[model samples]
Target: MDVDARLRELGLELPEPMTPAGNYLPAKAAGDLLYLSGMGPIRPDGTLVAGKVGDGGLDLDTAREAARLTGLQMLAAMRAELGDLDRVRSVVKLFGMVNCRPGFTRTPAVIDGCSDLLVAVLGDRGRGARSAVGMAELPFDIAVEIEAVVQVAP
Candidate 1:
């Protein structure tokens, strides 16, 4: 399938790939696996959905949207690395972290926002192993941060 075409069909446009805020690269390739650094749900204007889940006015639904935004950022990074989304073979794994208030435990459901978006865009190729955890705080207090491992055409 033409992944880029699929994105268009879904009425989605790729955001600009984000530059690393630190010294690490956005993505690194090792054989078939492309490892993506932790990506935040940054909007086109470069604003983040900053807050803690279940606190500071952030809730599960909002945090879920943040996760979806992170998925978009992930794809943006992937395209920047491979030059095309069609180069992707499958999503392998995802490690999602949500910034939350104490006692928040619905992390998995929040990260599913990203998972669902991936499947909506990539079909079966989007299915993958995943883990979601809560964090006391994340860099910049972004609502969610996600790192991914993907398989790409070689």
Candidate 2:
């Protein structure tokens, strides 16, 4: 499928890829696999979506939206690294972390926002093994953070 066209059809515009905050590269290629470093919900205007989620914190829906925004950031990074989204063959796995209160147990539901978006854009190729867990804190108190492993065409 034409991934760029797919994005256009969805009325989604990818934000500019983020620069690495530390010494690590934003994404690294190992053979046909692309390992993406952890990414947060950075909006198109370059503002971060930061908060704790669940249990009197940011609501579930808002946290989910943050996860979706983080997904967009990942896509932006992928395009920067691969030059085209079409080069992605499949999503392999995702490690999603939600910043939440101690009792929060809906992390998977919140992370579904990103998962759902990927499936919408890439069809079956977007389905992947995933783990979603809650964290007491994350860098800059971002609502959600995620890292991905993707298979890419050489």
Candidate 3:
């Protein structure tokens, strides 16, 4: 299916590309690969969903949602970088980091939120290798952060 149709079917709207908080570019392309910087769970309104997962303030489901949102944000960045979502050939890899309370071991499940959304939007092209790990803390104390590598059409 076309990307737009998929997005609409999923009831998802891509937000405006987020501005980089640091000096690095949000995304960069090299040959067929587009690399995105790590992005946190900031909403469309520019507010962060900040907290540690498995903590009282953020639960697994919420962190999972945050991962999904982070995926969308990365897609927004990709669109901004490539000028069109159709330029994407496939998702290549994803690295996810969760800021969580001590002893939280369900990082992979939380990161699935992102993986599932990508597949929903891009079908088989979204399937890719991934790594999900917990961190003692993340920038802004956001519940989850993720980065991606995508292979784009020439």
Which candidate would rank higher by TM-score, 1 or 3?
A: 1
Q: Could you tally the backbone clashes for each prediction?
A: 0, 0, 0
**How well does candidate 2 match the true structure in TM-score terms?**
0.98
Poorly placed runs, candidate 1 (over 4 Å):
none
Better of 1 and 2 by TM-score: 2
Off by over 4 Å in 2: none
User: Which of 2 and 3 is ahead in lDDT?
Assistant: 2
Residues 15-114 of candidate 1 have per-residue lDDT tens digits of: 9988899999999999989999999999778899999887555988998999999999999999999998888999999999999999889999999999
Candidates' C-alpha lDDT? 0.93, 0.94, 0.90
For model 3, how does the per-residue alpha-carbon lDDT over 1-154 read when each residue is reduced to its tens digit?
5788778888899988778888999999999999999997777787888898885768989889899889899888988998888888999999999998898999999999999999989999999999999999898788888999999998
TM-score of each predicted structure versus truth: 0.97, 0.98, 0.96
- Candidate 2 per-residue lDDT, tens place, 22-134, comes to 99998999999999999999877789999999777899999999999999999999999999899999999999999999989999999999999999898899999999999
**Clash pairs for candidate 3:** none
